[model samples]
Target: MKIEILGTGCSKCKRLEERTNEAVTELGLEAEVVKVEELDQIMEYGVFKTPGLVVDGEVKESGKVPTVKAIKQLLS
Candidate 1:
């Protein structure tokens, strides 16, 4: 699965990234996790807020940092 974390390197963004990775590890899914920092790329996903989560090209969450449990639920 293709998992992308969208952010401009903010604290919340970092937290999301870490939690996403933890979810991926716990799930044992062989997925690629990328950090999208470009404004154009983030806008392309129609997200105006930092710390966005994109899975398989679909925007899942944005604006707030999600907890590990929340991320695991999303990944599942």
Candidate 2:
């Protein structure tokens, strides 16, 4: 599985990245988690918000940081 966190390195974006790591660890799932910091790259996902989550090329969440449990649910 592949995951992407879209943001420009803001505080919330950093938190989301951390939570994503925790979620992946707790789930014992191997996923390539990446941060999309570039504006062009982020825009490609069609997310106007800084914080976004994408799983396997599909947008899952946006505009806010989700809890680790919530991310786990999304991953599942």
Candidate 3:
């Protein structure tokens, strides 16, 4: 699976990334996690929010940081 975290390196963005990593680790899934910092790239996903989560090219969450458990559910 591929997980993408969209943000411009803000605090919330970083937190989302960290939680995503924890989720993936706990799930024991082999996935690639990428940080999308470029505005154009982020806009391509149609997410106007800073913290967005995309799982397998589909936008799952946006605008806020989700907890590790929440992220695990999303990944699942």
TM of each candidate vs. truth: 0.97, 0.97, 0.98
Q: What is the lDDT of residue 28 in candidate 2?
A: 99
lDDT of each: 0.95, 0.95, 0.95
Candidate 2, residue 58: the lDDT equals 95
- What does the lDDT come to for candidate 2? 0.95
Model 2 stretches astray by more than 4 angstroms: none
Q: What is the per-residue lDDT of model 1 for residues 6-28, given as tens digits with 9 covering 90 to 100?
A: 99999999999999999999999
TM-score of 2: 0.97
Local error of candidate 1 at residue 19 (angstroms) = 0.3
The positional error of residue 67 in candidate 1, measured at the CA in angstroms, is 0.8
Cα error, residue 1 of model 1, in Å, equals 0.3
